[model samples]
Target: MAILRRQFAAALAVTGLGVGLAGCAVSQDRAGSTPVGVADSLYWNGPILTMNDAQPQVEAVAVRAGRIVAAGTRADVARWQGSTTQVVDLQGRTLIPGFVDPHSHLGGVGLQAIAANLLPPPDGPNTGIAQLQETLRRYINTSPDVRELQVAFGFGYDDSQLSERRHPTRDELDAVSTTLPIVAIHQSGHFAALNSKALERAGITAQTPDPQGGVIRRRAGSREPDGVLEENAYFGALQHLMPRLTVEQSVGWLEKSQALYLQFGYTTVQDGRADPGGVDTAIAAAKMGKLKVDVVSYPDILTMGEGRFMQGPYYSRNYQQHFRIGGVKLTLDGSPQGKTAWLTQPYLQPPAGQPASYAGYGVMSNAQATAQIEKAFANNWQILVHANGDAAIDQMIQGVQAARARYDSAGTLQDRRPVLIHGQTLRRDQVDKIKALGIFPSLFPMHTYYWGDWHRSSVLGDPRAQNISPTGWVLAQGMRFTTHHDAPVVLPSSIRVLDATVNRTTRSGQVLGPEHRVSPWIALQAMTLWPAWQHFEAEHKGSIEVGKLADLVVLSGNPLTVPHAQLIDLKVLQTIKEGVVVYQAP
Candidate 1:
């Protein structure tokens, strides 16, 4: 999707590009070019979305060093053009501020890339076990590089879709690989199906009891555990059997992931959960100056041990240009669709014949979760908790409130904007409380499209299902919000999330909840500016204005002008960060 010249012309007029540039250039040139010791970079002939209300549009932007020097018309920036300056002509493309993904698991995404690739369930109808097995066989056989540990991904096996309406058991996975261990991660990332060998390798057996905050599905007649592992149980068991990648290997995968982010027009990414190794890898990349995209690493608070270096004022000034230790991430609950998320009320319907009374709750105890939050708060670290269900949200709110009360009494409550990531199923009453606490909600609205149908039937039922993201409701409550794809959890594409937000259409082409749908403008802000605010980088990034970082994405069409469904198809022509062209389409 090449940028069309017509779009630029429209933006040029709105931005007063020609007039502003001509005036600025004449004024600057008359004053003589004094060596300011700062190099200049200029981008011209493009439609620029400033994201700033005072000056909403611009035709060109000039950058000095790494900050925007001026934003106006092509002529206005021409005066800054010197022999040492780097100039890029966007040729009438639509340029908007670079996207900031508020929530993403960078290491998980890299791991998925290293794992097997399986075909997703067919678009129209469900492919039964026989068909699915054949497809899996083909993928395994064709991809010879996928060795004995034949772990394949991308299986969207909803219960209703299957004739048996049950999770594929260890016996079924044995058909694929007996000697080698195999694990098929569900789309929701909350559940995973492991083969018998894989389970045995992790020392899980028929006598093994379910761990707290996690479940191991068991057969009805026998005490033998089914292959299905839910929540932390799945992660815990899998962590044992999974092969560990070396630091170099991890860095390679991260580099590949960063390239993909750049292709999608992201300049900054918040690593939603970072293990110690992952944090080390990020630091290594930053130190070597190999990181192309800006990174904010949020270390996983769950793994912190006593007397260990936990929270950080650990700033590397040399790497500060592209990397920062932003905060700590704590996952309080799992996904709602997976039925593992702790909710205030029981699920609408139990899985198949299971009694409604048997619906599960969140994995972590309230005390344990609260302690983690309090410790992070005490250490002056920003906290981002992943809480999806209303019950989980309630717990999170309680934790935040308690922490605030404790800190305030000691006169140590500096305004820390602790965020609740994926507050998807929050209750109406909790909305005001979130605003009052200054706790930002990073809404995962993309779920409305990906699992809307499943949610309508199995998970949330009808009433609460429609209120999933509640973008409109959140706005009405005056709560700040940011939206994300949670990359690798899904593909990291803001366009897809925007399409889902505006269109509200399911994979089956049905619009689920029209009431919760937000306008294009609001959706755009949630992806761009709101995310910057969540990360406390609003002052430097998020918007296009003087003194801000020059990070922008040039597109083929104005997202506002395009039809809702067409937003996903809009092409990115170029991506610029710190006034340098980071990516450009041929």
Candidate 2:
């Protein structure tokens, strides 16, 4: 440490840093530490876009002990340059604060990785059941883990993309292997299909009554289970199917997920809807010192009990070595693209089993959900409810209003920063209510890029479909909102998130809503600064300003100056967390 300090001093003198360069070596206590001294590192010579509106841009940033000490023109921050200070030459590249994706499933990413890939273009090429089966068979044949488990587990099956234009049936999956239990989860993560053998294991039978808030799609006429499960039924089935992963195994999966997130320039990620077991695994990983990226988890309000929610030791908002239990995650309904979200208007084209008037069903009764919300608030936990359907949003609105009235009727609203997750089908009036109530919205607008056409033609007719995420509506009200890719539901691609937010373009080269499109700068803010604010970490994160954590990323090109089409092609050149490089492109 002494030698390093000497080097820092000598380097500062040699670099001709003006004014008291030697004084930088004298560290001070809390009351009076010279803010702009010889920095441990400096990044200069590029477009440094700080999301801070005060000093929107800076040429150089100096870091001391993992916190920014200087951010200004090259000459202004040059005094921090020293021999020991690692200087990073940006070489005309672009630098912004590291992307903060508030609504993702980092832990789920590992689970998704272990399963067979059944997604459509860009990730996998399974456009039909044949390709899906091929991919499953390939995973079974190649993955020794699958062979040992004696079950074929796959995820990311999208009926919307299927050539058959429907979910694969049990008989089709039985074709994979009649003896082995097979389960293929839908891309929405709200549904799953089980083969005959898997169904028998989960005890879903012809006589078994449909669980409340969930469905077991039956075969043509009779009550024979068709093996497809939605909402709570899917979660119930998964409770039976998911194996007991060891702590080490869970850590390995988290590490794998972290590596992928780091590549995408994610310093902070989320495990949005961690079940109790998932939360345990995350805590175990944190205690063992295995976490590399910050993970804020929200255990499902339904799956976990009040006792657990009230007494769980992992339920703190503070960073406990890269892990924190943000709050409780409640799912009010299913995905809009799956034609299962509880919408006010009927779906343009309902799925096979439902009537034309079928709008979707809530995953829980209003009484049950409101009870959970009341309990969560009673315990002082921040609530981030998942309400993709407009009706579900209504549930959230009523529930939150009642909770606030019951608990803090003095107009405080608990100051909990209650969140409305997804809100894909959120209405404009709800936008006003959300703003008035001080609820934060972490919206999923990538639906425009991934499922816009499907939403327009089948899930929701044109008018409603065009407003899926409605980020622009929130902006119009002068309310702040954040955007996300909801990793595992989709690959948490940062550029793709930004691109979709900025363009609102569907895959078919059509703009879903031109007015809904935000600027590239606003899109960047959604990913960086705004999400930080949503998570209540804006002070230390969100911007490249002095005294904040030097968590930043360098891109191959500036997102602000890029053409819309080329935004998706931009690469993350380097990712720095607390001024230390964590990832760099090959």
- lDDT by residue for model 1 over 1-586, one digit each (tens)? 0122432233334322231222112111111234333336566666778877788788777788778888886555555655545455555567789988899977667666655543245332344656555655665666543563345443444444556656678888779878777777765677888888889888899888888888888877777878888887897896787666666666887888888788888999878778777887887777777788898878888765541434344432123647777778888888777777877777877765367774457757888888888887787778899999888888898899888887756655467789988887887888988888878889888887777887898788877888888887898886668889887767777778888878788868878778878887778888888899888888888988888888888888888777877887888766778877687665
Error of 1 at 514 (Å): 2.4
* TM-score of every model versus the real structure: 0.88, 0.93
Give lDDT tens digits, candidate 2, residues 1-586. 3443443344334342221111122221111223346787776667999988888899878899989999997666766765456655566788899999889887788878778988998789999999999998889889876875677789898999899988888989999888888899898888899999999888889998888888889999999988788887888887777777777877787788888899999988888878777788888888998876788888887778654744766677678878888788888888888877898888899899789999998988899889988887888888899999999999998888878888886846568889899999889899999888778999998999889988888888878989988988999999889999888899888988999999988889899988789988898888999988888889889899888988888888988888988899998877888877788676
lDDT of each: 0.73, 0.83
Error of 1 at 530 (Å): 1.3
Candidate 2 clashes between residue pairs 3 or more apart in a chain or in different chains: 11-83
RMSD of 1: 5.7
- What ranges in model 2 sit over 4 Å off? 1-36, 309-313
